[model samples]
Target: MTQPSPLSDRRVVLAVAVLCCFLWGSAVPALKIGYGVFGIVPSDTATLLLFAGVRFSLAGALLLGYALATGKPVGLDRRTLGRVSLLGLVSTAGQYLFYYVGLAHSTGVKTSITTSSSTFFSAILAHWLYTNDKLTGRRLVGCLLGFAGVVAVNLSGAGLDLAFSVLGEGFILIAALLFSLGGIYGKRVSGQLDVMVMTGWQLGLGGLMLAVAGLATGGHLGGFGWEGVLLLAYLAALSSAAFALWALLLKHNPVGSVAIFNCLIPVFGVSLSGLVLGESFLEWKNLVALALVSVGIWLATARKDSVVGRPSP
Candidate 1:
């Protein structure tokens, strides 16, 4: 197999990272539409799990199929299997379990803002886990700017709420933390395993667990239709592509560098929600938020010597 270029190649990293974040951003609206098509109300915990289980399981299958077709090795050693399964559990099943329930209890705006905290978690974790990815002033400023953009974009819809719930905001934070940990762990695993293969197995194993739990709890989609199936398929494809690419990126880049892109997810989510759900798209804050996010990405990812297109010192 040909060795891929280092993620320090700014152009390739930016393109792939943007694509991954855009796919994830689209999921926000896609999932909202999916819930309606599948007749899953906010209170439908079991059905939500069932829906997510199906989506992820299918995504795993698609990734594995792609790997086989592309002649990538699909076999994993027993130890690798165990590690990948653990990664899947924390990253996919556990993260989404909390996320779905939390989103159900909280508003979409709040969910987006809270989940954006994962970048902070990842940056902090990387400082401890990776010597090369130490926390720096530039990275901190970038993360804060991106976080502010997230807050700015959601400000219109997120009316002040003094009340907070453990199940609502708390779970979202937990999911964010778990997601950060999962990214770090995934980087470790990808060093030894093929990125696609690792992603496929973990998603399959974790998704199977979710399916079993949902089924055991009497989860079933009501009024299943062709539209619902198609949407589910779309979601699965997004997961397979985004996660595999993400794993690959994390394997080659500093965790903080790649993790900073997570801030883009909510930006894409808000913009898409406006277009798809007929919300106002002309808000001034939206533009400001995007500008801030752009600056944030630049600051976080740009090499010190390359800041002004200068060669390394």
Candidate 2:
């Protein structure tokens, strides 16, 4: 008898997926602190890219090192090399480029809502790409619930605005679209390459592109005091762990199943940002957002049978 892989279990998938989202959510505050510690102004797009590049570069190095230490093949053939690099550029470099710049031009509330659209994008893209991963009523309802939670979490203060700009919400939407496309592309590539090695290369290569572009655009990064060093290290650590887990999940599960958890990122991001930055996060909206997202996750992943991502062909 063949034993089912642990990742095929819904409970394990939920735990790992949530953990990955939590780590990513914490990056919100850590990034703010990082900017202050390193003296990066909001308008300094060059420095922002440089900082992101360094963090992702270090993260890639960490994963690659671990892969090497564990005796996994990190070397890529020519065919796979190009594919991985393109994935890196689209998913990492291109996505973050728009994200950082757009964030500067948009409000945080708007940004959160805009980026949450990636979950929907992933679901829709999955519907077209995978025969078995059709967008059903349950999936649609679950996505709507999750998106409502995202909106609820960001309903603090002035609430959402009608104003939109190309550089602001527009760029973020592009990032979200790229993220969805990248996840699908990555799933296809992961079948041809080791997940760890592919992720490491994409991060490393994409980060290198960002670093070079930042430098060409007059970006400078320094002032690595012990605090700064530790902060950067923490950011890198989180990226490496979170991205690797996410890629692993995508490899084994449907994009909609795993990608739906993205809504929780804002929930955790808002809560942790408030806690760390001394802002109020215990408001009714936050609680409501959490409840909505929880139910959404349950609805998205709830299945009658033990079968998980794969269905009968």
Candidate 3:
């Protein structure tokens, strides 16, 4: 069979991004399911941490395995390794710990909405940290729009179990902060190590750290079942693969473009929630909010005077 053209490969990349969005979007629901099967919901602290810890641990190990199989597990210089470690601590540990725990407190939709703000936070953080990543009026507007989208989502969830209280929103917001720091660190190290190697180290080492923290915090490790395996599998494969792709994109592409796609998190989150949880489908408010988010993402990520877009998709 003939190889596909470059255009086709580009299409493939967009397709992969969409898939990554979907999988990442579905992560909260998977956490919910973990609560059900393993009894690890809000009431079960030990199990909840275990749920996050074990899945992350396995995911990290798997990525490391890939690194080893590819023959370069230790590819970073000491300085780069230090950066990766710091990023892993902040992004993977600080971010995901709160995120998963927040998932325990909120619904799939709420989690998505809050986590979706990572893009907005990342935009600001990138501009602050990276001199080349200065933001324009569009970017600022986009960040505001995305924030408005979160407000819209919370308003929509007023009566639902997924409703966002200040506490829940706070958790998600903290997660976003950690993610932004991690993303910035990733940007710095993107040139140093292979994406796969960096991911493996980050995930593997970070996961190990979380496991130790989980154990110390009395996070249970029991309740192994099919659900545990499935949750672990989903977290390991889908999440890791998307992140690796993201790291690759961040390595080779612009931060703004990748950041713009952060809006897709809520879209996929709401979509998966409806399909998987029987939540009501889209409402007019959601549509309006989505439009705002779209405009915001465009402004935040796109160039100001130069109409040249990031590579299509």
Candidate 4:
């Protein structure tokens, strides 16, 4: 019999999930700053891949080391190794391949808004994949409301740009879809695996694939300094922490219930990106967006009679 996770508690879920969102949200600005520090131009696809690859590789190493140091089981059988490797490919490597490239071509605000669509994707997938997690009217409304906030963030100034680019917003949407699918798979696999070990292996294997791809395609990264190294370390640290925590949450909760918190990422991303990257964020729409997303979160998670953490009958 599987022991219940303390993370399944609603309050703990809310707190830790929000913490994950905050960490992920801060990644927007951090990544952009990393680009500058490493002297990666927008056109440098190979180097971009290399940079992302290295960050995840280090993150994976950190998690694996921590898992071992803490006396957690780190050994995997062939079947489990295959599963974790696939997860690494889909969740980390595949998603970030598009994400890193997409971010290079789009503004942080725009990228954040677009990627927020992953919430909806996860919700839709969970609706089909899990009986207990069927998409209810309340959940739909909550998702829409949260998504409305995502839209409102860009409505300020000249309003949202209607322009779409294959390499920009298009790639971001693809990444979102990949991430949603990966979440479902991760949830399924975590049922029998230690969340920490699973997350670490996936990150390490996926990151290694990315690094190899970047190198094979002639991606080279240079311009290393103390600042650059430190920034890279921070990115790695944040990924290690946030991803490990998120995997634990998914191990205990419904995908929709947990994924709804992704709406908060853009809220944090826009605000942080504006402050850190010198983009405009002090618009009236931002406050309205925040309110809508907050209500959406409450509606999604605060069900009085919800059996959210249970598996389907």
With candidate 1 superimposed using the best TM-score fit, by how many Å does residue 10's alpha carbon deviate from the native?
Answer: 1.1
TM-score (all chains, Cα) for each model: 0.93, 0.96, 0.80, 0.93
Q: Which stretches of candidate 2 lie over 4 Å from their true place?
A: 1-3, 304-313
lDDT of 3 by residue, 1-313 (tens): 5543332243444566667777887985776676777765475545555566667667767787877887875666778878878877886877877876676666655676677777867766656655455666767777778767755655654544545665566788889878877866775676667777777778766777777777887877556777677777887887678778777666544465567667767766765777788887577766776787767756654552221113222
- Give the Cα lDDT of each candidate: 0.85, 0.90, 0.68, 0.87
Deviating ranges (above 4 Å) for candidate 3: 1-16, 73-80, 100-114, 157-168, 302-313
**For residues 1-313, could you state the per-residue lDDT of candidate 1 as single tens digits?**
5554565567888999999999999998898899888878878887888888989999999999999999998988788888998998999899989988898899877888899999999989888777678679999999999998888888865465646788999999999999999989988888788889889987887788788778888899765688888898999999999999998888777888888899889888888988999978678888988999889989988863211111112
The candidate 3 region of ten consecutive residues with least summed lDDT is: 304-313
Clashes of each: 0, 0, 4, 0
In lDDT terms, how accurate is model 3?
0.68
| Top candidate when judged by lDDT against the true structure | 2
**Candidate 2 TM-score to native:** 0.96
Model 4, total clashes:
0
Clashing pairs in 1: none
RMSD of 2: 1.8
Cα-based RMSD of candidate 4 = 2.1
**What are the runs in model 1 whose C-alpha is more than 4 Å off?**
1-6, 157-159, 304-313
What tens-digit string does per-residue lDDT give for candidate 2 at 21-140? 999999999998988999999889998999999999999999999999999999988999999999999999999999989999999889999999999999998888776677788988
